[model samples]
Target: MRNKIFQKLKQGYSHLGLGDDILQAHAEGLVATGLVTDENIDNVVNTQKSFLESLQKANDARATSAATRAKEAARKEFEDAAKAAADEKARKEKEEREHKEKEKEMPDWYKTEKAASDKTIRELLDSIKTMKEGYDTMKDENDRFKVEKAVTERKNLIISKAKELGIPQYRIDEGFAIADDADEAKIGEYLTKVANNTKAQVLPGNRDMFPLADKQPSVENIKSIVDKLCPK
Candidate 1:
């Protein structure tokens, strides 16, 4: 009967997947307690089998709970990682878009400086052009003034020399009209010829017509004659 109980306990514990060492320890403990008997042997086997089944069920429940906890943790980790990656991607895309926008537009400071520089260049060019025009105009006026001064001096010299030669005003006027472009030497020669012609035109016994032909004229007589002939 003891052997039959031992066999039954071994078969039952083995079916419950208990290790050899645990089954041996439990069987030895039951024998030391004097619980195995012909009358209670089947009851002891059934009771031990029932206790082992309840323990296995509790272990399975804990293992199932632990597996569920681990699966939930893994899913949360995956979701958190996915969210972080999406946020990083969005941040990089936003930065790239801002960079592209910056590339399309120039800075305000640079645009303002360039515009000011262009304006200054135009003003400088205009100033230079205006100065050049003013210089040219002044040069032309100066040249015209010099020419007019030279012509006036030449006319004054011719008139003075003609008066000194005692040439008549009418003859001097005719000479001035004909010798408009004559130099000092030509004017002097022309006045000398007119004086000689006046001396040669002295009429015989016409003393009044040739008074100055025989004698050198006084400065006052020449002035009086010139004033009467040429007036103011």
Candidate 2:
């Protein structure tokens, strides 16, 4: 229908020397002579308005499609960024574990130094233990309060020395808890045994400083502490 209107306009304006100007002198001459009616000019105006409306609708559709495409692209980019961040975190954790494993493979010099340090610590502990034993033997002779005070001081000294030898504070505390009823000599031996290993070092051969004769788990020992669980 729109095409038909354009054809009509062309035929009517042909006599005006191809000029579609609304007020062409030739067109005006035709209109005054009644060759072309006012209806023909009105038709031309209505045709242009219809064409402009069609073009605007096409432009609006294109803009909507472009907005949709832009939104989808942004969503895809966000997903990719999230995946990349998770992968980077996993890579860092793996690298840290590998680094720690390498560190655990100590050099020969470090082992020798550690062994000598252990020997020195053990000797100091043995001397301290001997002194404590002498104090214990005089338990009846010495004032009770004086003996308890001396034992507390010796225990503190042992804890400080153990920390200096690189034992973790928690392990020292655990040792004290496990050896609360043990004599000062036994406490020295237990700490000395643990002094060679890294922080939070568990006793390799035995978990208990005072194992029961029945070989049963008491309220103090939890199996999970000594055993590593398989992942589900």
lDDT against the true structure, each candidate: 0.76, 0.61
Model 1 residue runs over 4 Å out of place are: 1-105, 174-181, 202-232
Q: Candidate 2, residues 39-90: lDDT per residue as tens digits? A: 5755543444454455456767888999999999999999999999999999
Q: Count clashes in each candidate, considering only residues at least 3 apart in sequence or on different chains.
A: 0, 0
lDDT, candidate 1, 50-98, per-residue tens: 7777766786788899999999999999999999999999999999999
Residue 22 accuracy (lDDT) in model 1: 62
Best by lDDT: 1
- Candidate 1: global Cα-lDDT? 0.76
